[model samples]
Target: MKIQVLFFGITTDLVGSSTLELNIVDVATVADFKKSLKEKYHQLENLNSYAIAVNESYAADNLLLKESDVVAVIPPVSGG
Candidate 1:
């Protein structure tokens, strides 16, 4: 399955791209996708934490992903 991934804030810098079209195994879960990303982009593992949003909504690790799903990687934010 293919999906669109969006990177935000520090994530974009880490990945070197604001967006990517990736091909993943069918019926992969959010956790699986995340693992794949970390493997492809080792820099991603440097982040303390990040959130995964599917179709504009925060998704859990167990959330199943589908073809063409829009996944966003939002790194932790802090503002004073």
Candidate 2:
């Protein structure tokens, strides 16, 4: 199975790309994808917090992922 991942804010800077086409297993979950990302992109692990949105709404770690699912990596926001 494969999925499209969208990167936003600082996540795009850390990942060095705005979009990623990932090849994963059929039983992958949101958490699983995140773990894989942290393994491949160690910079993400240093972030204060990271969030993921599936489809359009914020998703939990256990949320099941599908082949065509659209996952977005939402970086934390900071302001003065």
Best by TM-score: 1
Model 1: weakest 10-residue lDDT segment is 42-51
Each candidate structure's TM-score, on Cα atoms with residue i matched to residue i, is 0.98, 0.94
**lDDT tens per residue, model 2, 1-80:** 98999999989999999999998888988989999999999999878888899999999999999988999999888899
Candidate 1 per-residue lDDT, tens place, 16-48, comes to 999999999998999999999999999999998
RMSD to native for every prediction? 0.4, 0.9
- What TM-score should be assigned to candidate 1? 0.98
Candidate 2 residue 37 Cα shift, in angstroms, is 0.7
